[model samples]
Target: MSEMCPCGALLGESLMPREMAEEGIFSNLLEILMSASSEIEQACKDSNESVDLDTCLLLTAECFRCLRNACVECAKNQHVMRNLGLISTSVHLIKLLHGIQMKEELLLTALRCSLQFLGNIAAGNRDSQNSIWKCAFPDLFLTCLTYNDEKIVAYCCMILFTCLNSEKVRELLDPGNLTVAFHVLKVYKEQLESEWSFLIVTDHLLKCPELVKALYAKLSNQERVTLLELIMVNVNEKNPVTSEEVNVLMTHADFLAGCFQENCEAVLKLTSAADAEDEEALVTIRLLDVLCEMTSNNGQIEHLQSLPGLLETAIDTLRLTHIAGKQAVNIFTATHAMTGQEEISHPAVGFKSHLIRLIGNLCYKNKKNQDKVYELDGIPLILDNCSIDDNNPFVNQWAVYAIRNLTEHNERNQELIAQMEEKGLADNSALESMGLEIEKRDDKLILRSVRKKPS
Candidate 1:
């Protein structure tokens, strides 16, 4: 047969000579250059037609494996540009990578691999920076935000977030890209409940401080209110634990703080009618805690003025003995102390008892509020309740703490402690067990005790 093509014949006939092929001699002698070149040429011809970009991208990804094998030869001959068609193919693939329906995992893998190769070529070629490929590709990167896949949306957000650091890339992303990113956040917010996705978007927003400020500026009052309401609803929802809820609250903390500072009365108005029967009270309490923490510096004095009554309501709700309501009462107590406000007293004995108990708890459990604890003129009343015979540990523990905190600093407090001690109201064993040591010096009673457990 007119000297069978040496390369194919050599590859085939070498199989018969175990020593030659198996010993790796004939294998080294054979060259598949024409075979690989033919395949690449075919891929290039296909790229010239209006082929499906996804199909072309998949083929090119496979070709990269073959190209890698022939890299030494291709480099020696400087035939790398012969794969210009592959770069063009990547440009087309970038377009197909847009839409919302593409398989996110597959598309992401292909696009990243192709982009890596394109970047490699650009790095290798001196003129590649000025090539049309630069302009042709970034738009596709922007379009990635439109993908319906939350994972892909999160990935695109991360990429955009990183790209913004580059002055050149930042210039390329106009308001349109930002708008697209925000839209993606809105559209896929529900899917972004995962902690990773939430953190990605949150970090992105935080890095772009201008973006957060812009969002604050662009949102109308009603829109801002609605956003807060949505956040509250999500935080209150009985869904599986997700990062999105926590992130939403954390991300919006600054904005909420600003809103409270600007109009505390308005924000407080939203929390006015929390009902004991509503399960959402716990969330309301949490939001209040966040607001309190945010405004700890007394930025919203008027806002805090409205809290004591709510604190009273929360304390009453705790009588149902729900742990959540009790926790809420604890938070409300802290908020009152932070705001330099006292819990408003109810006229009824039962309600007043609850208030006294809450005050006692604060006096004992919260050291930050020690100064504020002295502000409650109800310490003597709390000591009287403690002196009464009650089976409630809540009452007894708080009473001891209130006695300790109240007596720790003042001579007047020491006289009350002595009165309680004379009435046998002070539990000596309990005091000893709690490791509290009280000693009198000159004009003041000293607390020679340290907190064994954190309050």
Candidate 2:
């Protein structure tokens, strides 16, 4: 008899071009796994010795690894494994190991290897993928995703990414079950540090604009924040936004505007800056950033601006954060003047700049929004926020852009800004700090750079 390791047989078969099914290697591997499962169950029930359980787990893991290797790019072996009920066996073993409190490393390793097998076998095979999906669609996958083990969570995500066809994704997005998918996305955001497995799955789901729209409609406010963060992650990565990303932004523009409106309402309700310094405010700040990105895309700005309460939300958020930020700066300056300690700007400090950016994009070549901002007295607010702040980086630049957008082709807005500068209502300290001085020449404010003496 040939002296061959049962777990190593399929691995060798994987190295050759010949099909494992042609040589009955798949059957042999299944037999080894069955024998190992029996041993594991028997050891768990009857044996008090830890060594017996460890040995069986190691054998089971090896068998899983062998099968995982065999199924790699081998449709015949994958079909054979599925036909022999390996998928159920793998899920059963995972459930078995999940129940047992044996060595943690061995147990998790077996679980991870089992998921690897399922993922590879179902990689490109629709029938096999559907089979695995039927066995472990939401509950088992969600349960595995909640595991503290990142590798296990990542493998579960891989299985999801592999098996979730468009129909399945839409099914998962249904109201009753979307929570499970949403939970997986939350886990992707909060739990997993690695992005490959999670990114592919999220990217795939986000590609279906209508499906994503439905998914967005079903999320609560907090869940909406999480989903926006996920979308922003992908948006921030691509240099020039792809067409697919543009479609997503266009589809969600109105909903995103409504989300901002709700977040801004929450901000306006807070009576004090201290109350606005919590995680909810942070989420609001992030939502502002997302809106900033959305408005930057010209195609979506009209949709965003047309939504009721968007302008009110933007102005309200700016006014609230501006008051809080100024109070924070005043306090910091008074206390740190002599000590020269670096001021830590308030948590809401960045909110002003982002809100300004949103206003700028909304006003870009849009006279109606420009007239509306002037009516709301937002120009002075924008002018006042032009000074530099450590927390709101590039705020001055955003204010400048907003001013230009507010004035472009709008004589009323232009006159308002010019009047503010002429009355010295807009302080000159901001201009002097930037080594630029404004002079009224020919009834126009001309910005002139300051000259330095030669050294």
Give candidates' CA RMSD values in order.
Answer: 15.0, 5.7
Worst 10 residues of 1 by lDDT: 21-30
Q: Can you write out model 1's per-residue Cα lDDT over 1-455, one digit (the tens) per residue?
A: 32322111222333333222221221221222223334444545565644354554455445443332232212321133333344454445445444324564555655554444343334334344334234443575546556555544554443344333333333333555555434534533555454433443344443343455555455545334333444444433323246653444444554544443344222222222343223233333333444433323232323332333433332333322223223444222212222334343311113223444434443333343344443443443454444332222245555565566555555555555554554576654555544564566775544456566655
Candidate 2: clashing pairs of residues: none
Worst 10 residues of 2 by lDDT: 330-339
lDDT (C-alpha, whole model) for all candidates: 0.40, 0.70
User: In candidate 1, residue 315 scores what lDDT?
Assistant: 33
TM-score of each: 0.38, 0.79
Please give the lDDT score at residue 224 for candidate 1: 40
Error of 2 at 331 (Å): 8.3
On the 0 to 100 scale, the lDDT of residue 82 in model 2 is: 90
